[model samples]
Target: MSDFVLTTPVVLTIFNRAHLAKRVFEEIRRAKPTKLYVIADGPRPNHPYDKERCLAARAVVEAVDWDCQVFKNYSDDNLGCGRRTASGLDWVFSMEEQAIIFDDDCLPHQTLFRFYQEMLDRYRGDDRIVSISGNNYRFSGQRLHYSYHFSRFPHLWGWATWRDVWQRYYDFKINLWPEIRDNNWLTDIFGLVQAEAGPSSEVFKTICRDEDIRYWSRKFNIIHKEMWNTWDYQFFFMCFLQNGLAVLPNVNLVSNIGFGDEATHTCSVTELANVPTEPMTFPVLHPPFMIADAFADAYMQLIFNRSC
Candidate 1:
């Protein structure tokens, strides 16, 4: 473990992957945060092996021998990804004002904790900046004078946020979907033509129609159907709706290791899987002006379109 200790609280969400959970937990152990919150979902009733896997995963959290105040929000029943994660986050913000959140598959570099702590302190009162993300998927040579850039994409592989932002804007229900769609909120945020031509437009159309394509007969499988029912899209919707920006590190800090048969959503290996992490330099360079990088956003939209 390094001499550096994280002052910010960390919230980790884990399911039934013991090996991946242990790898991520080791990073958390290195940070040695003062407070740790573990949110876990119970095993699926249909899968016999899920129970044992879930137990093993939880044991990793219990094995933390560091001096920390650990909190748990393990569910007795499988609440699905949507309900379980949303409720777990609700519980987290209820107790803490702000926290750095992690999924079991998201392995962070040592500097990630320091970067989050500094960024959180720097933008604590800035409502415009709602989140700080550790993963930077853009591999382009686009260099910024700052250690981070403002983006519309709030990548949640590993991130940090304040309770005020979560409570005020993050809606699990997508309650504002109708109003947002009818009033052309997407167009307003990403330009009228871009919104109409992008993948987000398809998602907006789906949400507005409440069309359950589960039985649409054209879907490749049940996984494709379940993919639409995700909270990440809802969080992105919230960020767009609130005109909120997410700060992404200049260097990639987190690697995703959850793509396989056992994975819930990310079942296919992509270019983003297991990306090498690099340490971020201190005294973070700050952009002179607060504005989203259009080129980066366009590249991200391209990635989203391809992924869908």
Candidate 2:
């Protein structure tokens, strides 16, 4: 029997996009998860829709009608980006063995439930495999088949991971510069490109800088030695160091929905609206390719050149 089920709690972190957050809520309802953990932070002062956003976010919970348990960690005072997000994540992983986490702007494909379930079951015992994520940017020659790919980047829009894997996660390092020095193994770990944030990284880091020092800088510290990445570029490094793999779907199973002005990050408004949402299958094809250190350096050069 498979340990996979569609009834697990889907954790959502919301901070003011009432409208888009509702869409995410409805999608979760369609899945009919057994439990739902909502961590909604209070809006920052001077921001528009301060009251409306909170009310709209709360309405999502009230609209739901089922045998669902909602656990809320609402902030009376705004904890900004760092404390609010990092603390909420700390609370969510405190309970379940695995979970499907999403921000307010992300919309899920109907099949995301099964995809997370199967990935959870497949890599349950593998400490090497830290997370199962949605949204792969490079689909040109990529297959719609189930296979593991490496990532050092963080793809927070939609992703899944085990609590055990998260237990090793310590999000606060104040300064990553020293960790770089302490860890001799990090020479190939964080190259110049991995040190800075690019298109998506910059957008998010800007929002988080006010609350947390900066997500990219924080992540650079985390992987300063060798840690799992759920961040944009950190995903690649995370997989490379562990020699882990990611399961990719045959079709584009997920899409990015955070391209609006209300979005804290990803407000560029790209043409990703046309991507199809298909459920991925299990028994994925494990790619033989491993992300080598040389490749990491080359990628860093390209990313740095393009961004600079």
Residue lDDT tens for model 1, 138-214: 65657576899989889899999999988988877676665655665554555543224565553223232112121
Off by over 4 Å in 2: 1-4, 143-148, 174-177, 181-187, 190-246, 270-275, 281-308
List runs of model 1 lying over 4 Å from the truth: 1-3, 192-229
lDDT of 2 by residue, 1-308 (tens): 14545865798888777777888888888787888888888877786677677867877767778778889889876676556766787799888888888887778887777767776887787856667777654434453233545455334567888787666644333233465345533444433223356766653211111212233344465555445323344444445455454544444556666676766545556545435566555546655554422343334334433332
TM-score for each prediction?
0.87, 0.72
Q: What is the lDDT of residue 90 in candidate 2?
A: 79
User: Whose TM-score is greatest here?
Assistant: 1
Clashes of each: 0, 25
Clashes of 2: 25
Best by lDDT: 1
